[model samples]
Target chain A: MVSIQNLHKKFGKHTVLDGLELNIDDHGIIAVLGPNGSGKTTLIKSILGMVVPEKGSIHINGKPLKNNWEYRKEIDYLPQIANFPGNLTVIELLKMIKDLRGEAKREQELINFFGVNKFIDKKLTNLSGGMKQKVNLVLTFMFDSPLVILDEPTTGLDPVSILKLKELLHKEKASGKTILVTSHIMEFVESVSDRIVFLWEGKIYFNGSVEELKEKTNQRDFEHAIATLLTGEHV
Target chain B: MFKILKYSFFDLTRSSWSYIYFLFYLLLGIVLLFLNNDLSNAVITLMNVIIILVPLIGTIFGVMYFYNSREFTELLLAQPVKRTSIFLGQYLGVAVSLSLSLVLGLGIPFIAYGLFQSPAIWDFTMLLITGVFLTLIFSALAFNIALSSENKIKGFGYAILMWLLLAVVYDGVFLLSLVYFQEYPLDKFSLIATMLNPIDLSRILILLKLDISALLGYTGAVFKQFFGTSFGSVISLSVLVLWTILPLLNIARIVKKKDF
Candidate 1:
């Protein structure tokens, strides 16, 4: 589980995240939805300790992340676009991460479930956009770390690859790994997320299950429900 | 620190081309030795310049290599690795790699030439080691610039300025001071000023080996009194090591707190 309390992040005069509080429980796929620059990436980055918050703290599994960085071993992150050195073949990159993690079983399971075998020998830069995203997905799953934070995980994937990813994600969920994902692709969010966190204007507008969101908006689908909530004025 | 250094060594080994220029320099050293059958004073003077130039090349390319690898560096930072490890690892990697290449390129020939010329082997070896330390000092400065600057042009510009200062301008200014301070005992001042630049220190160490420390004019005598002893040389080298380490420490701090 993760807890974020009253988080405020600013870049110079621009406040990207302000007075934001949210909690995530164990073993659920939570999809964060927001418009551009609505602090989606900033929130994920803050959780991963890529960006420092101006005010407040984030706790992962009862322990606060510190400058010492021992907390990071429990987390895996997939940025919107994962880039590596052009010379790094998929196997080398994965091997390097595996070496860094120093884990055996977790690395084996993640690599197996993610189907990293297809492009294991391919250089990262030479892969197609979809394949590159798959490589990122594979690495994110590779360590089997307890908490996985993925920003736009399904972007650039073909329908088949997307389906394959959903299958793997559901299996991971059933096995009780906490996942926090952010995506603009509403359909995938609608299908996969157990809960939806609607962020608007640097604040959490709504936090509820997908069905609950639809029920509150009186809509049939999660997408239309979120659209109504995001466009409406009242919280 | 050891882990960081280990990872950095592997990273540099993967690139491989960074050492090519040093190999070229080594080949040049062998050719220089090949040309001088007698190992005359002229060859010795040219070798003096080569000693300084070896590390100069190391600093330039080492800075550029680290700068070029920024994307990989960013990715590495996001991991569980500590900032200090990352900083120290990369610094030591560049320092060690360049030092090895330089020694291979220059040391082998220097020794082979020494055997023929009857020059003091220990003295020459000491000078080579001093050159490597000097190279590491400037490489650290250049590495710090690359790490702190977002723009490559700005980082490179700062690197060039650093080289100009230590390698060229420092000597020019010292010569100017010598002209101005002709009447006074500027020996101590000259020694301190020369020591301020690692390049000058390296030059003096080499000159000291050739028994031409006197030709350094009055400052040479001052250096002879101050750093002439074996202990004095070790202290000066330690000071150079400190100079290399301190900026890298500051860089580690900045890199830790830096958002990217």
Candidate 2:
């Protein structure tokens, strides 16, 4: 379980995260939906301990998150901007990450499932955008870490690769691995997420199961439901 | 510590073929130092290059390496490893690579000259190796500033300022003071001033090695009397080591507390 308590973060005169609190447990995928500059990225980075908060604290798996890097070993993150050294090939990148984590075995089945094996030997810089995203997804799922955080995971992905990634996430979910994903794509979020979190103005406006959000907002579809909840429209 | 050292050497060795250009320049400098049978002029010319050019090259290389590896540093910081390990890895990597290049560039040719011409010249050649490490100390200081700044221009600007302060301004301040204190005893004070600049320290040590410390007149005599022996050799080496240690510790603190 991951818990954030009264977290506050500021950059000089402006506040990015304002006394925010959240709780997540081992479950199927939870999707955090927010517009740009809404502090979604800041929240994820804070969980990873990449950004220090001025107030409050976070705990993961019964341990304080700050400076407790042992908890990070259990979490795998796929950043929104996935970048790697251009000189390294896809296979070499996988190998390096595996070696760094000292993991004895990795799940390479995603590679074959996603059709990435055809160009696994090619340099990352030479691959197409969708192919690179596939590689990033494969690497993130390489270890069987309990908590996986993927930001904009489906961006630039072709239809087939996108379907394959959704299938992979489902399988990981079935294995009881907790997943937190942030994406602006409504349909993708609706298909995979069991719970939805809405962030507006650096605070959680809503948090509940997708069905509950639909019933509470009185909308026929998740897209219209989100629009009504965000802009407060009756139609 | 040992893991960092091992990986540091590996990182340097990975770029072996590419950095041969650095080796080439080093060899050229040494060959130019010993083209003549007369050792005095060659040593003087070599000292001039070591005192001035080596630090400049070191600063450029160090800054470029840190600036280029920014992403890798961010990735490393995200891992479970200790911040000190990351810093020591980077520092050792830069220091050892520069030191090896120095040895290959200047040490080999100096040794060959000592063997071919006269064995007694070996002491002076060893003194030259000491100066190479002094270059590493100054280079490490330049690297710290480059790594801490995210803006490339700002980082490079700070690095150049450090280079100028150690390489030129420190000496300029001392030389300007000489005119004002013409009557006072400034000989002992000059040695103290050189301590603030590694380039000046290299010049003083190399000058003393060539038995030309007397050229500075009364200051020369005082310097030689104070630091003319093998004990002086250790002090110079310690001063260089201090430069490496202090900057590395400072950089480690900044890196640990920094939000990447």
Best candidate, DockQ-wise? 1
Report the C-alpha displacement of residue B34, candidate 1, in angstroms. Answer: 1.8
Report the poorest 10 consecutive residues by lDDT, candidate 2 chain A. A99-108
Residues B1-260, candidate 2: write the lDDT tens digits: 44545554565567763277467756665667656665566666666666666677677767876776665566665555666776677667776777677666665766666645664375456555765676567667766887678798898888888777877787777778977898998866876776666676666666666666554444445666787656665676677777678887788777656665
The digit string of per-residue lDDT tens for model 1 on A18-78 reads 9999988758799988888999999988887778787898998888865757778888888
**Candidate 1: global Cα-lDDT?**
0.75
Which parts of model 1 are misplaced by more than 4 Å? A106-115, A215-221, A228-232, B1-4, B14-16, B38-47, B50-55, B111-119, B181-188, B226-232
| Model 1: lDDT of residue B179 | 96
Q: Against the true structure, what is each candidate's TM-score?
A: 0.89, 0.90
CA lDDT of each candidate? 0.75, 0.75
Give, for candidate 1 chain B, the lowest lDDT window spanning 10 residues.
Answer: B38-47
For candidate 2, chain B by itself scores a TM value of: 0.85
Please give the DockQ score of every candidate, comma-separated: 0.61, 0.49
Write the residue-wise lDDT of candidate 1 on B1-260 in tens digits.
Answer: 56657666676767666568567766766776677554444346545675557556656866787876666666666677776676677788877877777777677776677643565555556656776776677778877788778788888888888777777787788899899878998877886786677777666666666666556555556777766755556656766777777877777777766666
Residues A1-235, candidate 2: write the lDDT tens digits: 9999998888777788888899997588999887788788889888888888889999998799766666778888887866765666888777766766777255467787777899999988898878888887887887778999988999899887778889888998999999999998899999999999888777887899889989988988999899888786653
